[model samples]
Target chain A: MKFSKKDLIKLYTNLVRARTFDMLCTRLLAEGKFVSFYHEGAWGDAAGVGTATFLRKDDILYPHHRAHGFPHMIGKGVDPKYYLAEHCGRATGCCSGVGTVHALFEEYGILGQSAILGAQFTVSVGWGLAAKKNGTGQVVVASFGDGTLARGTWHEGANVAVLWKLPIVYVLENNGIAQYVSLEKAYPLKDMASLAAGYGMPAVVVDGQDIVAVAEAVGEAVKRARQGKGPTFVECKTIRVTSHGYGSPHMVDGEQRDMNMVEELKKREPLSMYEKNLLKQGIITKEDIEEIAKAAKEEAAAAEKFAMESPIQEDASILDQYLYAE
Target chain B: MRLLQYNEAINEALSEELARDEKVFLLGEGVGVSSLATTRGLVQKFGPDRVIDTPIAEAAITGCAIGAATMGYRPIADLMYSDFLYTAADDVLIRAPQWRFLHGGRQSLPIVFIAGSGGYRKVGPEHSHSPHSIMLHHPGLKVVVPSTPYDAKGLLKASIRDDNPVFYMFHKALIGMKEDIPEEEYIIPLGQAKVRREGTDVTVVAASYMNYLAIQAADKLKGEISVEVIDPRTLEPLDLDTILKSVIKTGRVVIVDEDTERCGFAGELMAQIMEHAFDELDAPIKRVCAANYPIPSGFLEKFVLPQPAQILAAIREVVK
Candidate 1:
């Protein structure tokens, strides 16, 4: 529950990095750099980076498409050029620009990122089962949104994970809204933690905006799993300040629809909130935070230049490759 | 040569594969104590480490197999019945097929998906059916339907060794049928067809249990019609070379499929034949397929399924 000076600084650096990366993605999409882009705001940084910091090199992280920040947080030293190239759909990108941004990196432990809801939850079980079967004691984290909680595979996968006592952790990012609809309209339950109780696994509800709180809660879950106990469901009450897809309009066709919660949701920017808390606690100066933000922006610019120059993915042999391991 | 039942031959293949490679393991409901008898005694042979018995979570388990396959483990998922394929279709049909291509060929998914397919012994509408053709609709996954015990052992071995995901179906009615299989280890390469009968009159295409029926029909009308029954054991990467050769020699083709007539594999075969070898055909490619309807309970199931009489009629019509 306590923290070190290095911990807070590391957290701040990752949040800044993620925010800058996300901003560049939005800017490129606006400039028509790519045909499509899924925009997740800066609010997701604390929860994504917080959880990823706890994973060891051997441990696996299976993220949904919305959690691009998780891999960016996994290691700050990753060449942003490869990631930017992937965004531009270039042959120089990791996966030769053929992979979407979600499924980009694997060497950094970003094993997979599925677009389908709750699909990774089930798939991670296999990874966890293998770890246990091999006696490796390695843990695999399965991350998804609150909307995916209603999916049958989530429960189906959780059932086997708990029954077999597999080393898998479920981290649910509860952003309160699925696409356009609010949680109240979709799930009858107020707290998703109770769903874990049904499977007899320990569950916790944490403040997603607080990176310290998320790390502490997920750290315990990771420990318990590594101890050969079972899976843990950690539901973080998070925020999403932008529209579900690329740019906001929340509209169908050409017409704009009603969005009453945007202004209220905008009030709690996680980065700003964390900075205010840090200042109040007398841990850091305003100039220090500014320095972090400046560095992140510079890194983002370098990645952008690299992506612009990268070549688009094209090859005559693409047809024959990737169909089989042979 | 040794006489082993269909399921026993399949069991031998699993045992040998598991022993041959420490990475190969079986996981599914009823695998510890195989309900269909195909996976029976595996847990005893391999122990719990290799033969895993999971709860009835089809979709999730299939996802688990895919993920494990990504991490260099060869997993054989038992679906219990092929009808329950819908429970796991999203991962098997979507993710498993695309993972190889999606990652730019960096990852190879080596997983064998095994299921009991066919309508017999009144397992009812949902349980008693073969959806192999439906599986063919998904690109990049291999489909294997083994009719005889010898092919069952060989193809199962070949599927496990292949780097791609192979969906293998075992005919429920043929599990008890016995055949003389070689004592020495063997693997019939996937995408190879076997000629059950040699004839110049007509080429009868059948698979799994349908091959058995086609052979029976060929025998019943032996003197009058010389029916050449060719079993294209593996659906994808189909041995069109052998099939087209027989088509040119016979100049007539009769396809018998248990799948529904509408949007079925039989229709796909007919189209491919027309596209490649239209000039060799003496008559329109004939088809004896199940009705485009669900298999209801009771004697109606038998009526709805493809029968030898239908194959006989198709042979007679095509030969004329």
Candidate 2:
């Protein structure tokens, strides 16, 4: 599947925007501007952006918690201001300040996500069920980290997805770590896509650092799902260039990551790699790359300003108001 | 009025709901040939699309109901036995109930989780326990425990229509019990207490199968000791006002529950009665619940479960 020049630029713009927003949020976390814990997506931008960029507005998306879902939501066309405000616990947040950084853009088919890892696998089946029953050709894309695959719901949900042939694409961003545990330590299989065979679902593995590769792989899965080909498991072998979360230890299994390996992983950072690829293909010149970077920075600044200006949610009435629908 | 068994009434409710709305569907491990008979014959009426028989995966079944609910569909997930709820506790106790609140209350999960609860089938510890107390401890879930076929049909219809997540716990002991229900469609709103047997000496608050026991105990002690029985069908939206009104009239109360005594629904009701009507009490409130132990199977089960004799003894002690 070949992408047009327009698609390449859009993917590049999303990759840059996701990185800028993530960096700004990390800085804000360090400055104590936000109270919630931050998980930096770091080098996992291509997996998030590529998986979600081509999805239709009606297609449901359950984003992984990497970078607090900035890349996926941004790729799905949601403005970053509401996301920042949600993290800041401001009244104007997407969830009205209740969800601390969780994204819920219902209009773009991005419903809420669970704080419990891998809980979305079971729920994604229902979305797929609804899409199939609705017969509108609206596919569901459920993204999660490699660690989440170990959850029992993954097997149960996958079995049903294949058995019923639900229209869904299970996008696995294999970052090789769940919190502080490495994938090699947690999972027996090096290629997580092999697990999909037991469910009789088709599987693919891609270079997550390359935006075009990730996009092409996920785009084909999405197309297959839309065509009623049941579900597909696409494992993007990615890397977490930082600790599990901001301000957390860089240790995995009580051993500090070798600084050299960390530096080596950072060398293939998604934004820079995608930028170079675009420049080589003449899809975007160095000047265009700088312009995109500047615009992303400006957008991040405006989003931060909007979040800072929003009112804090401290009213006691919200306790009862949001507890249950009348 | 036509007669229906407790399980049959539940089947009717599910059938009516599925027929009434296109969005309503049923999914469970054996819903096509339900073991409890609550969902039997549903698959044939609704077909495979509407009546989904899923694998034995509680978390997946519950999560599918919740997920489908969010997408403008009402899903009724039947988890054969209430004891099996532990397998899907995360989705039932946390996700389904908290999903709406955590997401700013913008979404409503119109999902119903049906499970057969309590002992009498002698199904042992894993299969025969009534865990409504665990659900009551959680704030977001609406709990319904019906004692009779009439109440079962009415309350289930109401639970299906309710916008929030409702845990409908039917007693396994009462599955074969029969009673008359109106031919016309009727829905008993949640949180309403029904005065089963009216008396003046003591107010007996009970639920589910215990409500049936309380009524029997009240009849046995009739003329000797007048006992007023109040069955609170829904526990979460508890009809505390009705119980308080009865407490104000009788001035003495005894709560009966099949769940264990420690931190049970009976204890919670006793505390509320004490808090609201402490001044009106003429004697100390009493609770007749199962002993604080796992319900053993067979003949040993009677020792662990609450009996009618215990209700009588508690009533006598409270009225004194």
- In order, the candidates keep a fraction of the true contacts of 0.73, 0.69
Give candidate 2's error at residue B57 in angstroms.
Answer: 0.7
Clash pairs (backbone) in predicted model 2: none
**TM-scores, each model vs. reference:** 0.96, 0.99
> Under CAPRI classification, how is model 1 graded?
medium
The TM-score measured for candidate 2 stands at 0.99
Winner by lDDT: 2
Per-candidate iRMS values, in order, are: 1.4, 0.8
Which portions of model 1 show Cα errors greater than 4 Å? A67-80, A251-261, A280-283
Residue B92 of model 2 has an lDDT of: 97
lDDT of 1 by residue, B219-264 (tens): 9888899889999999976998899999999999999998888889
Model 2 DockQ class: high
By summed lDDT, the worst window of 10 consecutive residues in model 2 chain A runs over A315-324
Q: Per-residue alpha-carbon lDDT of model 2 for A137-192, expressed as tens digits?
A: 99999999988888999988999999999999999999888888988899887899
